[model samples]
Target: MREELLISRRGFMLAGGAALAAAARAGGGPAAGGVPNVVLCMTDDQGWGDVSYNGLKAIRTPALDAMAAAGLRFNRFYAGAPLCSPTRGSVLTGRHPNRYGCFMPGSPIRAQEMTIAQALRRAGYRTGHFGKWHLNGVSGPGKPIAADDPLSPGKMGFDEWLSVSNYFDTDWTFSRKGELEKHVGDGSDVIVAEALKFIAAAVREGRPFLAVIWFGSPHSPHKPLPEDQKAAGGSAYYGELVAVDRAMGRLRSELRALGVADNTLVWFNSDNGATPAGSNGPLRGHKATLWEGGIRVPGIIEWPAGIRKPATTDVPACTSDIYPTVLELAKVTVPNQITPLDGLSLVPLIEGRMERRAAPIAFWHNPARAGGQLNTATGHAALCDNRYKLHRLPDGNWQLYDLVEDISEKRDLAAEKPEIVQQMKTELLRWIDSVAASYRGEDYRRAGIPFAPATRPAGPATAPAARPRRQQRQQARRRRQ
Candidate 1:
C-alpha cells in the first residue's frame, strides 16, 4: 500500500507545428494501395533514453533518431504494462493486458479477444508477425512455435508468422508457420530481413499489409555480434542496439526501394523500461515498477504521406493506442466490434490536430492469474491521466505525482490534492471493474463464456470522469433507509 505525497513544480516542453491536418477520422490520407501500409516495430528492454534524439550518449541510434526527426515523436509514450508480454498484448488487442488475462510474460492471450491482426486480415490486409511471441503461454529460451499450438500466431489471426516462444539472440531458430528454420545474423537484422520479405510480397500482390516486427535483442544473455560488440566498446547491450539501428535503416531503405515508403507508417517503440545496461533517462524505477521509467518508452511514428514534417508532442500515450489507431487509419471496421477499448485513435495526434491525449492510459498487472484470483487490492494498477499519475500500491493505498513537474516521480501529491486523487481513484476503480468483467469471460460470446452486456458505464475505461464520494455516500444511505 502507499499514501499521500505533495507536489508543486514547473516544467517546459517544445512547441509543435505541422502540415496536412486531416478532418477524416478514418483513412488519414490517400495511400499507394488505397490504404496505408503499417509497420509496427518494438524492441526489448530499450528505454526512453536509449535513443540519441532522447539525449543518450551511451550508444548510437542514428536510424531511430532519424525517424524521430522525420516524423512525429512522442515525448510521453508508455507501454501498456512494464513487461514484455503484457505490453505486446496491449499492441495486439488495444486493451489492458489484464482484460484478457495476459498480465505477465509467458501469459497466454485468451482466444476470445479480437486482435488487430485478426481485424485487419478479415478486411483483406495481409497480416504477419515476426520474432518474439511470448503470448502463446510459453517460456524459457526462444524456440520455434509448434504448429499444433492453439495460441500460435496462425491461430491468433496472422496468415504468416516467423516467430519464437520468447526472446531470441543471434543465429536463433524460429517457427516459419510451424516449420523449423534457423537464421544466422544479428537478431534484429535477421527479423527485419524476414519482415522485409513479407512486406515485399504484400506490395507485389497490391495488398496493404500489417507487419508486426517484435525484435528480440538487448534483453538478456547480452549476446551481440562480435563486430557490433567491439564497435560498442565491448558492451553487449549497446552492441545489440547498433545492429538494431542498422536493421531499421535497412527496413526503411527497402520500403523506399519498393516505392511504398511514403504511405507506409512505421511505428517504433520499446516493450518496456530499460535494464541496468540501458537508461530510463531522468525517470525513476526500472523494468517492473509503476513509475515513469518502467512504463515510459521511446515512441516515434513515421508516415511520410501523412506527417510531412518533424514534430514532437508531450501528450501521454500508450501501446494500447496502436490497435484502434491502425484500424481507423486502414478504415477496417470490425463487425460486432468489442466495445470499451482502452485505446483511442491517434490519427488526430499524427495529423497534428490533437493537442492533448483524451483518455487516461490504465496499466494493470494482476499476475495471480494462473488459478489464483486476481488481487486488484494487492496487485499493481496505475492511471496516467494527462500530467498526473496515480499509482495503486500492493497494499491498496495510493500515491499521486505531477509528472510534468517531477518527471523522476520524486514528489507525491496525494495528500495535497485529495480532490484530484479521489476523482482519479474513482476512474481507476471503474476501469478495474471493466477489466475484471472481461477477465471473467463476460465480454466473450461463446457456449461456455456467455456474452453479457455491460450493466454500468465504464467511465474510466475511455474518458476521465468522476462520480463524487459524498454523493455516492448520500445515495447509498438513501437506498439503505
Candidate 2:
C-alpha cells in the first residue's frame, strides 16, 4: 500500500509539471511582458530593531531607511525558523525546513529539493549566489567545500557563485565557482563587489538576472573596518552592522548607475532575529527560541517599475514566501510539485489587495546535535495568524499570545481562550504530522527521483518521552530569569 501511494503521488507531480510547461510555452514565459531583474539580499543575525528606520537609535542604516521610504515595507516579516540553515532552506524551496529534514543550523538541504534559482534559470534568467551559502554543511568558518560536494550552489542551479561555507570575516577566503580565492576588505563589501560583476555582465548581454546576496556580517566574532568601528561607538557588533549599511548604499547606487534600478526588484531582510548585541524591539526572547524576537526581522522591497508609491503593511510574511512571490511576479511556473509548500505568494499583498494573510505560518525546531541528529525529546513549535500566536514547547505545555495587543508576549491568554487554543492546537498538530511524514522520505519517492537519506543518520528509535511537569516549570523559570 505504501509503495502504491508513492507511485501515485509521483505520477501526479509529473503531470502537473507537464501542464506548467505547456502554459509557459503558450505565454513565452516572462519575456513577453519584460521580466524585472530580481535581487534578494539577506543579512545574518540582524534584528527587527537593527535598522535605523525601525527605531534603532544607536545604529544608523540610512540606505535601508531610504529603501523602506521608497518601496513596500513589511512591518511583521518573519524568518521561517529561528536558526540560519533552516531559514535559508525555506527561502529557496518555499517550504518549511523541517519538511526536508533541515532542522537546525549546519544541516544540509537534501539534493532532491528544487530551489528557486533552478526554477528561475529554467525561465531564462541568469542565476548567481554570492556570499554565504550555508545550506551545504561546512566544518567551520572560511573552509573550502570540495568540488564534488553534492550540495554546492552549482548543483543547486546557480550558474555562477562566490560563496563561503559559513560566516566569514574581513580578508576572508571564499570559493569562487569551486576555486579558492582570497579577498580583502570587509566581507559584506567583498561579496557585493563580486555580485555586481556578475550583474554587470548579465546586463551587458541584455539578460534578466536573479542575484542572491547573503551577507555574513553581524553574526558573531564581530569584526568591522577601522572607520566603521569608530563610527559604531566602541561596539564591534554595531560596527559590523554599519559596514552592512554602507554596503547596501553602495549596491543601490550601483544599480542606478547601471540603469537597472528602475526595473530591478531589490528585496532585503535578515535570516533570523537579533544576537545579544542587537535588539528585538519590544518582543520577548532572542535568536534561538520561537519568540517574536527570534523569528521576526526587517523586510523591505523596492521596485520603481512596480511600486510607484512607498507604503508599509502589517500583514505577516516569512522567508518561505520569497520563492512563490518571485515566481508569480516573473510569470515563471514550477515544473513540478516539488513538495508541500508552506509559503503563499504575496503578489496580492504587494498590489494592496490583501488586507490579511489567508493562511497561517508555522515554525518547528527540534533540539538536535551539530551533526543534525535529534538528541533530546525537546522541541519547539508555533503557529501564528494575523492576531494570535500559539506556542507548543517540548514538555507538552502550551502558551497563547495576542500578538496585536502584546507584541512583547508578556501576557498569556491560553486559559482565557480555551476554544481558540484548542482549535489552533488541532491544526498545528495535524501540520506537524504531515511534516513528520515528509521527513520519513514520503515526499521524495517520485517516479524518476531517488530518495536520499537525511544528512544526519537517525539513531535507534526510543519511546516517546517528556520531561516532568515540575522540571519543565523550573526550566521555564530559568529562561525567564
- Model 1 lDDT per residue over 277-381, tens place: 899999898898888889999999998988997899999888999999999999889887765689999999988899988889887766455442355555878
Index of the highest-lDDT prediction? 2
Clashes per model (N, Cα, C within 3 A): 4, 0
TM-score of each: 0.86, 0.86
**Whole-model lDDT, model 2:** 0.81
Model 2 alpha-carbon drift over 4 Å, by segment: 1-33, 367-378, 446-448, 454-481
Residue pairs in clash, model 2:
none
Off by more than 4 A, model 1: 1-33, 367-373, 446-481
C-alpha local distance difference test of each model: 0.80, 0.81
